[model samples]
Target chain A: MIIDVHVHTRLGPDPHGFAYLLDQAAELDVTLCVNSLSPKDGTGMPESPTEDEIRRCNDWTAELAAAHPERIIPMWYLNPAHEDFACRELEERLAAHAGLQGVKLWVAVRCNDPRLDPIMRLCAEHKLPVLQHTWFKVTGNLPGESTPMDLRELALRHPDVSFFWGHCGGDYEYGAKCARGLPNVYMDLGGGEAMNGYVDLLVEHETADHIVFGSDAPGRSLISQLAKVYGADLSDEEREKILHRNAQALFDQQKPANGAAS
Target chain B: MIDANAYLGNWPFRKLRYTTHIALLDKMDALGIEKAVVSSLENVFYKDQLAGNRRLHSEVHPHADRLLPAFTINPTFPGWEEDLDVCVQEFGMRVIRLHPNYHQYGLDSAAGSAVLDAARAHNFVVILATGLEDTRHHHPLVKVPDVPAEQVAAAVSAYADVQFLVAAANFSGVSAVWTEAAHTANVHFEISRVQGPVGDIEKLCGTVGADRVLLGTNLPLHVPEAATLAIEHAKITAAERRMIVQENATRLFGLG
Candidate 1:
């Protein structure tokens, strides 16, 4: 019942890096992958993806999930900059695909921006969780990128919406401290940074109640990232909460009863 | 598996746990790693690198069956040869780890040549640990960049006889530093740093040949399981997996 809450498929047709990830998940007894979209050349997301690009990437993600059936769960990718389009396309994508579970926010816009308000509002309406890609890079970050401090501000604002902070911010010790006391924010252990001791910080500060499994796959080694949790010093109860329970609760919350119309 | 890269002692940036030699071996034991070739983390920061080496030998010697200690040689410092001798002749350490970036010396410095000469003279396995953690996440004061792979490649080309292990380098390092083009065998890339999309140690094995990729967990600073599980999950052959998991490291470090 392991669910890798953070995973990526190629943008268009899936030429490189997907099969091995799928096979690794299957072999590892990982029941499902909550997959987002990225590029085929191993490059990351565009800073500002156009509306059509978002739709195209989401379409490809849905197709990968459909082709794989229960093994894949598509996470809708939305650039909050496309707020009106995001609110519109989110419902459209939800109505079209039933298993579509969460919204993935990459670096196109800072998670704390007012532009994200509408998307956050819509997610709260739908009870959907948002996985925001975050890093506190010593190198200059991208223009619209959100640091853990910024994410904390967002989490403080949107108390009802569950936000899975991706990569737990690169310097997770600092990031976890920043994320401390925010109950609605769950740190996704997905950064391929693979450094030690951050997980313990998450446990001490955020608690296992706020931890979830993710592998930042294809770009990072799935097992390496997976081992971030598997290799950490945690109790079985805490381990289960991180590996599946916490994520399942988030996925379970995304069920919209109104037939998915905007 | 022989985790050819790991550390013992404190890091100034992060409050590290599980860093004692016993904790490290226990971690390796839990991860099924037979031995770990470890260096002193404090050595990278300490100006008197020999003191760090002395601490490492003191910490690891009692657990020599499971822990193998390596000396951190700051080639820029005076009396480095004396320190190297004390570590080898007294502490009985066979591995030498160099931190050119942290120590602020070029890989082509006379100090570098002198260390290589000592390495060749002593038949020691030299490790170049350039990437400790991603520099982007360094402590505000400790923003050290990696020694460029080209520079290391040139050094590798220059000293064909020294068995070198490039620790914590990236996949581009595999391409630029030790690729099929080099057709070189004297150097090996530690696995903890070789990351990317489409990981199947097969891709690396296909490119560099299996003999050149060594398993190193960068333990205490990282998790040992991540390195071990990477080899377990790769789409490589059993023989290739064996080579990556332990064989390459065992042969490189003479850990028969």
Candidate 2:
């Protein structure tokens, strides 16, 4: 089954609404998609979404998941800067929606900001996986975006929490290098730039297990981006892991079969 | 079926994805690509135009029937004339690729004009590669400065008698350059870099005619399936698709 993890719904700034996105995904034969909330910072915190807005977005996702059932898996977007509000909303969403898999954070906040500790602690307590938007300082396009070094610091800070670095080996080769020994951290291959030697990089570095497939849909086409990975020279087993198994395994670990919260 | 713009070898900052030649070829072959005019990643990084060119030529030249070598020449190199001569004479490179931003030279400069002349003199087809990735989404420090369309227009005007291929250029860039150059009979636009829901080749062909658009897969860097699908799914007639895919390139590059 083709699953795209990095998907955006009309819950935020996208001009294209949720219905349009769903229709496009369905047309593309996407069985499963992780619909993430686009962050909003009315407070002028650069890329962070407001607390009330985040709650509303999560509520909308929960409603949508209820309607679609197995098709859509809502991934909560949280800004740790909102401290207590973030934990409250996370707990509220977890209690409200059993289908919700994990949390998505745009670490565009700042490299290793201490305020994020509470948010990571909450995820650790709930056993929820966190996907951070990561890149290298030099190669990353965004001026204020967090680098792989920042992600390494964040991973080291919260060793028990499962952190998935979004964009995988994007432009920064150092992210792959830093993620080699860190098992708790996984990388999503999508967005920004395409790396020249991605498959061999994963194999030689022995970080194949940490790599997962994600297409920053809308910004890119689901079919075309998936084709890049599908057409790559990887073993069937390795392709399966990157395509679906790894994501399923990560999500399953966070929410076990018993329907327990943690 | 040779793609004029393809890259092998390693791009720094990322792990070497496709290491061996067979590994790269097998992937390209799956996409229906028969032969590719490829350059080494080392040439892109160390700026050692000839060494990287020779390394690529030596590896792929033995299998020249399958892999055609296109030497990447850095106009910034002090001994660029000697390098260009060696590439054409020793390796039989008929095509040369230029990375303006990567090599830190303006295509409008006097030196760049000389490089163009040298390429024309050797009967080599010049391919100007615009941007590898979208600048908005690129690494902040790895700035992909636009390959000035006016400079390309000026070059086309300067050498109306010679033919050139522009790879990774957008629709607007193609249109602007072609319009200014007036006589675009000698220019061919490589379609891998320009993408949209609508087929760019069909649209461009309607404007610039089918003969000016050719099939190019920035393979390894880009997936060929979508581009291939775009050409296949275009609104143009089968004859036109054939022209864009094979006939146009065959005629322009003298591949037949």
Residue B12 of model 1, lDDT score: 82
In the range A212-239, model 1's lDDT, one tens digit per residue, is: 8887777777777777787778999999
CAPRI quality band, candidate 1 = medium
Q: Against the correct fold, how does model 2 do in TM-score?
A: 0.76
In candidate 1, what are the lDDT values of residues B1-256, reduced to their tens digit? 7888999999887777678887877777777888888899998889999889888888888888888888899989989888888988899878999999999988888888888888889988889887787788887777899998877887887888888898988776676786432537688888786655556476778878888888888877776667787788777788888888788888888886
TM-score to native of every candidate shown: 0.94, 0.76
What digit string (tens of lDDT, one per residue) describes model 2 on residues B1-256?
A: 5566677776654344444578768866776777676777677666568889878887897777777767788888889888888887788878888888788888878778888888778778888887675554455556667688887888877887778888877667787888888677778888776654223455588887888888776765665664665576556888888888878777777775
Estimate the Cα RMSD of every predicted model relative to the unseen true structure: 2.7, 5.3
Residue-level error in angstroms, candidate 1, position A118: 1.3
Best by DockQ: 1
Model 2, A105-152: lDDT tens per residue?
775475488878988887787777787887654433464467777788
| Model 1 lDDT, full chain set | 0.80
